[model samples]
Target: MRAIMGLDPVGAITRSVEAFLVALLMVFAVACEQAKLPNLLLISLDTVRADHCSAYGYGRSTTPVLEALSAEGIVCDAAYSVSPITAPSHATLFTGLMPQTHGLRVNGERLSDFGLTLAERLTAAGYQTAGVAGSFVLNRTFGLDRGFEFWDDYFPAEGSKHPSSEWMGHEVPAGFDRRADQTTEIAADFLRDSRDPDRPFFLFVHYFEPHGPYVPPDRWRKDFPCDQGSSELESMVSAYDAGLAFTDDEVGRLLKVLDEMGSTEDTIVIVTADHGEGLMTHGAMAHGQHLYDEAVRIPLMFRWPNRLAEGRKLAPAVSLADLAPTILELLGINEGAQEMDGRSFAPWLLSPSVEGVTFPVFMFRGKVRRAVVEKRWIEGERFGVLDGQWKFLTSESEEDELFDLEADPKERMNLASSYPQEVERLELLLNPWVRMKSPTDGSGITLSLEERQILEALGYGF
Candidate 1:
C-alpha cells in the first residue's frame, strides 16, 4: 500500500448523501528512501472545447504543451460538465455534489463554506491549500474560497471597479492575459515557497482567458482563421483557440517550475476546461444556452508521472464534479463526504475495470434542455437515447431534430416526427433528472449599485 503523510488542511472526514460511503484514511509515515509524492495541482481553463485541442483531434495547433503532457497522462475523451454556467458547474466540480443539491443554480449564487470543497477536504487532511483563480465568478465572496491558506483571486478590470449607473454593466478588461499571467506567478510562488516540506499542498489554479471577448495575445492571433466563417460564433471560436494557446504556454511555465522543484515525479497534475464553447452548431450564438455537446463536452487530461499509463483514453461517462472526492481519496483525507455526488476515478487511473460498472451523467442549460449520457449514447427528450452515431432533439419552440452524429456531428436534421416512441422514452428519462435541478437563486449577497450593473453586463439579469 502507498503510505501517505499527515493531513494538513484536511479536517474530519466528510459524509456523502448520495454515495453513502465513507472512505477510511490513515496517515502513514514514509521511509526516507521511498519516493516523495509531488503535490496535487488542479488547473481548470475557462471555456475550451475538447474538440479544439490537438491532443483531442483538433486540426489546429492549439495545444502543443498539453499534447506533450498527455504522453504520460490519462485522458477522458468523453468527459462532460453537468451544468453549462460557471457557478453551478464549478459547484458540482468542487463539492462532488449535484448542482440541485448544492443549491447554487445561478451565476450570481455562491457555494456554502459549510460545504466540503476539494480545497476544504484536502486542507483538513493536513495538506496546505491555496487558490489562484482568474475570474470574479470564482471569488471568495461566493464561498469558493473556503479552505485555502492563501486565496489571491483578483478579478480582471473588474477587480475593484463595480458597475456605475453610467457604464453599460461592465467592460471586458482589455488585457485579460496580462492579469492571468500574474495569477501564474502567484501559483508558482505558492508551489515553490509557501509549501511546507512536512506537508503536501492542493493548489487550484484557474485561468479565465478563453472565456469571452474573443481577444488573444497578438503573436497567436492568426493561429485560427477569421475566415472560418463571418458569423459571430465562428469568430468567437477563433478567438477562444488563440486564448487557449496563450493559456497552454502558462501551463508550460508551471510545469517547468514543478520540474525545477523536483516535484514532477510524484505530483498529480490535471488540465481541463469547465465546459465547451458553442460554434453555432445548433443555431446558438453562445454557450450556457444549450445542452448540446458544444456546451457540455470539454477536454479532461490527468498527468501523473508513471502512476498512469500514457496515451490511454477512458471511454466512460465522467463528470468534472467527480474531481473533488477522487483527489481526497488519493491524499488520505477520507472523511467529510456526507453529500458527494461524484465517484472517484483513482482506481480506474491505476488499472482498467470490467464493463458492468458504468455511471450516468446529466447536463443542463437553463430550463431549456437536459441530457442523460451513458457509455454509448447521449439522449435528449426528442429522440430519446442517441448513439454517437445519431443525435436527436425536440421542443415546442421547435419541432424535432435528428441527425446522424457519425455524419452530422454538427447536428443538422429533424427526425422527431418519425420517431415518437423513442422521443417519449427519452423524455421520460430526462424529466426526472430535470426535476432534480435546484431552481435558480440569485447570489445571496446584496450588491452595491455598481455590482448590480456589472452583473447585467456579464449576461446576468438584464
Candidate 2:
C-alpha cells in the first residue's frame, strides 16, 4: 500500500436544512422515476482563466457554448484550485485530496495508487469509465489512469511522437499534445461505440488548448488580426481567446452527441478548468510560478438540465478537491470504502437558498510557497494576507507592501505601515497553514535520464 503523509485544511459544511433539502430532492428525483444513476461527463479546460470566459463576464465572447450551458446549470463564481500546475491540480480534482496528501505536488510526479480515485469508485460501482486527455501530462504513467477502462493519452496516435529537444527549442524532452478536435473525436467515438447502453458511464475529457504555445486553429487565428503589430501581450491574449473559442466549439460538439444519444437530460455535465493562465497578470506568461488569482482561480460550472437549478450563480470559495466527493454524493454512492478529504457540496446544487459557505482554501506551489485564502483573506508567497479589500504582500527581500484589491486590482497601493495590526492578524493565520507538513517526500524519484530531461524541460527543478 502506498503511504500518505498528512492532511491539509478542507471544507466542511453541516447544515440541517441543506440536508433536508437534499433528501427531499433525492426523493423527488426517485419519484420522477429517473435513471438509477445519471451518466457523468467531466470536461476540463486546461489553462483557462475564469475571467476569460464570457460566462464570467469577460468583455470578449470567448465561451458562447459555455455561456449557454450556464443558463441550464449552476455556475460557481469563485472556484480556486489547489495548485497552478497541470498534474497536481488535476490530481486534487480527481481524488478530492490536496497535493500534500496525494503526493503529486509537482508536474512529473505520479498520484499514489493508494489514494482512491473518483474513476475507481465509479468503476467499482458498475459505471463504464473512460478518459481522453489532450495533454501528455495525464498519461497512465502519472497514476491517474487507474480505473479508466480506456485511457487515451494520444501517444500511440500517428505523428504523436515526443518532440526532440532541438525541435521543441528546449533541452528537455517535450510532450506531444493532441489538439482539442482529436480529443473530442476520440471521446465522441467512445460514446458512440459503447456496447453497454444500460450501464451508466463516466467520461473525462481534457482540453489542452490555450495552455502555452497558445496556437488556435487557423480560422480562430484569423479572428485576431495583428497586422498593425500589436504588443506581444495583445497577441498572446488574442491567441488564447481564439483557442478558447475553438475549445468551446468542440464542447458544443460533445454536448450535441449527448443530446443525440438522448442522454443529455439524464447526464450530469460538469465544465471546469484545472487552472488558469497568467496572461501578464502579476508579470507571468504561464502558470505554476505564482499563487495569484489568475493562476489559482478557475471556472466551475455544472449542468444537469432539469435536475439542478439553472442559471444560478453562487459566490463561495470552492476547491477543486470538492469535485470527486460531490459527484459521489449526487450519484447516491456511499464512499466510506476509503476516507476522502473532500466533502460533498451537493446541497448547493439541490437548493437555491442554500448559499455557498465560506471556507479556507489552501494552496501549495512546490515546497517554496504556500497560501491560505478565504472569502476576503488571501496570503501566499511574497504576497501576504489580502482581507476584505485590503491586501498585504511581502517581497522576496522581506519588504512589506499592501494594496486595496477593490480599488487596485493591479496591486499598486502600499498600505503596510498604514494598517500594521491587520498585517499581524493575517500573518498569525498564515504561519500555521504554511508550516503544515506535506504527506510524502519523494522529490528524489528515480527517473530515467530521458524522463529527467523531460521534467527539466517542463520547468521542474529536478
Candidate 3:
C-alpha cells in the first residue's frame, strides 16, 4: 500500500470516492435545472376581437376551437392590448414594454434590436425559435423579426402594397392564401426539422384572417346571418364571424398536430389577438382611430397540460406585455436573460388568486386620451396610468374623464364633475407614461421615383 503521505491505499481510495460523489451530485443538480425548461408556442390572431370569441362570451360562435383550448386552461377576461396598431402591439407583447418605450409607434416604424425579445431570451436558453408572421408589418423591416433563428415573413404578392388594409377591415390583396397557409407550413416544418438535443422551440405563428372584408370559406359563410339574423353592417359582422370560424378550425388543426406528435403535454400554448374590430362601437367602423373599448380589449388564453389547471379565468387587468414573462416563467428559464416590464402570471395559472398583488394594467392610444372605469383613471398622450375609477387623458388639450366601470361598463357617462379630487391623483401617475415616449424625427425609408409612382397608384407609401 504505497501512499505519497504515510497513509494506507484504502484511505486514499476513500478520499477519492468521496470527491467523486460530490462531483456527481453537482452535475445532477445542473441537469435537473436544465431539464425544467418547458417548450413554448405563442399564437397571434390578426383581427379577432375578444368580444367575438365564445370564451369571452360573444353572441356568435366565432371561436369554437379557441373555446375548446380555453376550456382546458385559463382565460383572461379584462385583457387589453398596449396599443391599437398591429406592429406596435406585437412589439409590446414580445418586449414586455409599451409601444412608446420600444419605439414601434406606428405601422411603418420599428423597435430597435438592442434589447432582448422573448424569443431572444429563449434562444439564449438553448431553445430553437421561429416566427411565421402573416402581415408585412411583422416583417424584419419593422424589427419584429429579431431574435428568431428563422423568420418567414411572406405576404401575398398583391398585398405587398396594402399595408393599411387592417383599417379597411380587409385581408391583404385579393388572393393571398400565402399569409395564413405559408405561416402554418413553415412553422410546422420548423417543428419537424428541429433536432432533439436542442432545447424545445418557441414558435410564434401570426394569422391575418377575420381582419377585414370578413371573407370566410363557403362552408362557414352561411352559418351566421347579418344582425342576429337583419343590415349590410350586420352581414359584415356575420362575415367577420365566418372568418373567425375558419381561424378557429385552423387552430384546431394545429392542436391536433401537437396531439399526434405527443407534444400537447409538453408544450405551453398561448392564443391572443393584437386588437378587436369594432362593429361600430363608439361610432367606429374598425381599429386605429379611437381607443374605444372595441379597439383596446383583446382575448388572451393559455393552455399547458400538467402545467396549469384547466377551466380557470383570471382577472387582474392583464395586458399583452404580461404574456412574455408569464411564458418564460412557466418554461423554467431563469438565466436573468433580460429585464422585461411584464410580470409573470405563472402563480395565477397554478392558483387563481391574484388578490394581494396590485398592478393595474394601463393602456394608451391617440394623441390625448381619457379614463375608463370607476375610481381607476388614466390620462396621457400615448401614455396612461390607471389609478384605482377616475381616468385622465393627456394631450395638448389635457382632458380628463371619470367612469364607474362597475356602474357604467359601457362608459356612457363621465363623472369628472363629482370626483375632482380623484382626477388630480391620477394626473401624477400619467406624467411618467408621457415622459417615457421617445420622440422620433426619423422618416420612412424613402422610395425611388418609380417606386413612389407605383405606391401612389396602389394607395400606399406616400
Among these predictions, the greatest lDDT belongs to 2
lDDT of 3 by residue, 287-368 (tens): 7654556777789998988768888888766778777777777777774323655667777777766544545556667442
> How do the predictions measure up, each by TM-score?
0.75, 0.78, 0.80
Per-residue lDDT tens digits of candidate 2, residues 57-162? 9988899999999999989987877778889888988888767567887777778864678888898889999999887788776788888888987443443434
Worst 10 residues of 1 by lDDT: 375-384
Worst 10 residues of 2 by lDDT: 371-380
Candidate that would win on TM-score = 3
- lDDT value for candidate 3? 0.70
**Residue 290, model 3, lDDT:** 49
TM-score of 1: 0.75
Query: What is the descending TM-score order?
Result: 3, 2, 1
> Candidate 1 on 1-462: residue-level lDDT in tens?
122565533333332422233222212234432434347888888877788888888888888998888877888877888766677777887888766557876566667643577777676667788888777677666777777788876544443223222221333332223344666888899887888888877788888777776677677777777874488666777777888888888888988989999888768898888877776665554566666777778888888876778888887757776777667666545585435666776677778764235554555544434432222222232212233344444443434555555655665555567767656645544444343433334434344565445434422231
List candidate 2 segments past 4 Å from native. 1-35, 156-162, 165-175, 336-338, 367-407, 410-425, 428-432, 442-462
User: Cα deviation of 268 in candidate 1 (Å)?
Assistant: 0.4
lDDT of 1 at 439: 36
